[model samples]
Target: MRVKGEIDAYEVMAVNPYKALIVPRMVSGFLITPILTLIGTFTGILGGYIITVMVQGSNAWGFMGNLFNWLDMTDILGGIIKAAFFGILVILISCYYGFHVRGGAAGVGQATNDAVVASVVSIMVMNYFLTTAFFGFNI
Candidate 1:
């Protein structure tokens, strides 16, 4: 919309661009990431079951039995927490870059590229700290 002057039209109507634009995305990312992570976790377990029990002919009972032993609530919660943080980081960074876009389509492309790079780098750095905090600094 910034490229097309839609945002300017919104401002002429006294609409708050940040609220209309960034907040929804931030909220959506904060809420949806955990949900998607949960779904992915279940699907991953199911896939593991398919591979181990069905494909490899391992005992289904054993797989099911040891699953809880190997995977705990802490691990799952940690993943969900990580997903939430990562989602927020990605959305906020993208929004920042997007809002600051200048020039034209080329600027949008550049902002997008920069946002992806920044998001990835920040996520990696944040992951290390989060993991250390969650699991503790053993070293």
Candidate 2:
């Protein structure tokens, strides 16, 4: 929309573009990331159960037993925390790049690349610290 002039049009019409466009996206990111993480975690566990019990012929009870023994609320909460932060980081960084975009289509391409790279780097850095904070120094 910024590239296509819609954002400017909105601004000209007395709408705050940031509030109109960015806030909803940031809010959605903040809310949706944890939900998606929970869904993915559940799906992964289910898939593991299927593969272990059905394909590998493992005892279903034993598999479930080990799952409960190894996984806990803390692990799930840590994952959700990390995912929520990562989502916010990605959205904020992308919005910042997008808001500052210039030079037309070429600018959009460069900004997009920069946003992705920055987001990945930010996520990796945040993941390390978040893990350390949650699980402590294990080395």
Candidate 3:
């Protein structure tokens, strides 16, 4: 919707419509991805701790020892990197479709659907490549 608004408003005035539509999302994604990744990572760890220690009656000390012993910096860094890339992917794909929306409300709806599907597919494909590049057969 933000991209659509920018495109619609600047369609006649902007010298470069693509830049007008894409820049804002790019900037926002770059700014937001790392913060979100940190929050998500901590939330995931907390959820795991709650489920394993509280719900499953596991020894908290043993769980923490095993988890910390098995998990390395590479694992955490790789997840953060993947999240950042996914954020950029979603922003770019969404802006691409939304900025080009036509027809009316129906087009906007179609564009939104396309954007979500494209983002998910792109994230999965990119995840495979990123995993290969980052971890090879170890993952």
Candidate 4:
């Protein structure tokens, strides 16, 4: 926890201030949230396309066509950028809570359980707030 002391939980797996800071900071980026966010984005887009095709049926082409048409380079790029931020948030929260999950075998289980719940909740909350902030009720 940076806010509290300096455990460097997953950082170095050692003890060196310089290498610890630099290495850990870099490695921390790809921890959990970012990966989950990317996964969520892929699945979310797939789900959207699937539902559009399935529900729209005869109009699926039109739907997909319009969807792709509206999504210009900026929109797509914005999505990737936003996803990266969301991923960071999710990972930070998860790592914050899960970094200290320790005890024994049972503690490991608890850590995993907490990590999953935190990750999902973090994603959902971020998704809602981000969507609202970006598009809100206008869309």
Model 1 bad stretches (over 4 Å): 137-139
Candidate 4 — which residues are off by over 4 angstroms?
Answer: 1-64, 137-139
lDDT of 1 at 58: 97
RMSD of 4: 6.1
Q: What is the full ranking by TM-score, best candidate first? A: 1, 2, 3, 4
Clashes in predicted model 3: 0
Pick by lDDT: which candidate is best?
1
List where candidate 2 sits over 4 angstroms from the true fold.
Answer: 137-139
| Residue 69 displacement (Å), model 2 | 1.6
- The TM-score obtained by model 1 is 0.90
Once fitted onto the true fold, the runs of candidate 3 whose alpha carbons sit more than 4 angstroms away are 1-11, 14-16, 137-139
> On residues 1-139, what C-alpha lDDT tens digit does candidate 1 reach at each position?
7877888898999999999999999999999999999999999999999999999999999999899779888989999999999999999999999987887999899999999999999999999999998878566
Please give the CA lDDT of all the candidate structures: 0.93, 0.93, 0.83, 0.64
TM-scores, each model vs. reference: 0.90, 0.90, 0.85, 0.56
lDDT of 3 by residue, 64-123 (tens): 899899999988888878878888888999888876778778888899999999998998
Residue pairs in collision within model 1:
none
Candidate 4: residue 7 lDDT (0-100): 57
